[model samples]
Target: MINRFLQNGLQGKYAHYQTDMLFNGLNWEMAGERPEGSHHSVWELLFHMNYWQDFILAELQEENPESPKDPSDSWPGSPFPSSEKEYTEMVTQFLKGLGRATQQASKDSLEESLGGRKRTPADMLMVLINHNSYHAGQVVYARRLIGAWPPPDGDESDE
Candidate 1:
């Protein structure tokens, strides 16, 4: 049940869900354009979210992932996507990273401490979920700011 929320679909059985919904219908311009008052664009936010997911997944897999404590490192930019193809590539990678994180989180590690950080592996997963949820809200708000709400092709089932 918990595993379903992490990577499978946005049908969060435990509570709120819907990552894909926020991003479903965005085109290159909609995603890459920064709203008037917002510093970070939607694309940047999605990339940042994927970065943390990949980072945690690497740690869980015992890889020597570079732990970027700097905010800029966590929120780097890409060449402005000149076409939908480039934007699609980033979106695909972001979703893939999330799916990988989901697979990693499915492993049972309730008793294993995360790098002696005291929080167990399970706790770390919860932290990621919370983090993703926080940014997902921002994505929704960004969409609304651009009048991109109710994404034409997005999943609208059950909010």
Candidate 2:
């Protein structure tokens, strides 16, 4: 059975909307052009999430997939997605793919060792979820710092 709390909290329309706002909100800016000394922007975060999901899903299935090569530890570069629509689509696709993987994953499959670390597929899945949420929190903070992020879209009435 799925974890009801996580499914309710993290795998529903609410989660999708929150992810959308973070990646493609009206206040969101381009992935390029950082403010001087800082690194990462809304664009980079989206790109990072998309890239890793592609990587992990392919690896989990033992399929050979070619992901863009980036040397930066932070995976920084001009955003892989050239436009907001593309970014939004990529996020949507990954969420769908993740849901499928979770539903189909057997306990044995989830618990299979990868890289000799005994990482269950569940471990990898949660990493993607947690990692994205972590960056989403950062995006929220960045928006707050600039006073650009408004009350989230679904809660517009509160604004």
Candidate 3:
């Protein structure tokens, strides 16, 4: 059903790559590297993605989270993570948000309005999935540009 599809999309099933797997085998140094011609580094992308994910999740929970007044607020901080620990924390948080969103998908009526807002959980989830997917590709491209693609556990033939 629609919920199943949403869940699959959140997990990157039947898509370019599993959302979680996209970050695998990437080291802190690589995550912080901004290949020439790229505007955002891998770490920045993850951070940005997590920021919006949290925003949508709050809405889903009826927490009434405020969207940043400025668009760039969602993309705050340096383009690169400061250290291995910082990079690891961001990756962990990103995965956790994805998991939370997937769980939310199965528990809601996709068409029901959330917090009296016109948008439903389904709409928010779709936005999150599409947002993540768009950036997932960029992450891969950044990796390839930096000669870090096919993450240690991944195979070039698989893509």
Candidate 4:
């Protein structure tokens, strides 16, 4: 159940814009570039999205995770990455964290409270789905604004 849900929503065919696809072909420079209407760069959005999901996943696993000092601290700071490696590393970490959480779904207690919250693992997953989808949409929009849509070979900036 967990695998299927994640596949379809987080990293699967059901999602029109898969996370991998959304981040694909983007160098650190491209990710840090904000399109006209986007308030946050792609890196910022991805960091924010990943932070929440990882936080909930940690709680679900009974791990001690640090909450952000302020709500905004959860997002990456100003002055995004200057190197492609840093960008790729974050993306890789996010994908791994997501996979770990999904694998634990069937093995872990989905009905138990995590971090004193009344919400269950199922609830956390629901939050992740909604939150990820929303931010993923933003990423897509940013890509479109910069003419990076239809990823990989399509970089409209040069054309």
Candidate 1 pairs with clashing backbones: none
After superposing candidate 2, which stretches have Cα over 4 Å from the reference?
Answer: 1-17, 27-38, 64-76, 79-81, 101-109, 112-117, 156-159
Q: Clash number for model 4?
A: 0
Highest lDDT: which candidate? 3
Give me the displacement of residue 28 in model 2, in angstroms.
6.8
Candidate 2 has a TM-score of 0.61
**Model 4 ranges off by over 4 Å:** 1-3, 12-15, 112-117, 153-159
Model 3 per-residue lDDT tens digits across residues 1-159: 888999999988887777888899999988888899888888889989999999999888898888789999877478778889988998999989999999988974889987688998899999999999999988888888899888888766323
Give residue 151's error in model 3 in angstroms: 1.1
What local distance difference test score does each model get? 0.69, 0.54, 0.87, 0.73
Best-to-worst TM-score order: 3, 4, 1, 2
The C-alpha RMSD in Å for every predicted model, in order, reads 3.1, 5.0, 1.4, 4.2
Give candidate 4's TM-score.
Answer: 0.82
Superposition-based RMSD of candidate 3 using all C-alpha atoms, in angstroms: 1.4
For residues 1-159, what per-residue lDDT tens digits would candidate 1 score against the true structure? 555445443223345445645578788888887788766778888778878877776776667598887778887565246678877887887777666666666776655786666766666677777788778777777777788776787544423
Instruction: Please give me the total number of clashing residue pairs in predicted model 3.
Output: 0
Residue range with the least summed lDDT across 10 consecutive positions in model 1: 8-17
lDDT of 2 at 148: 47
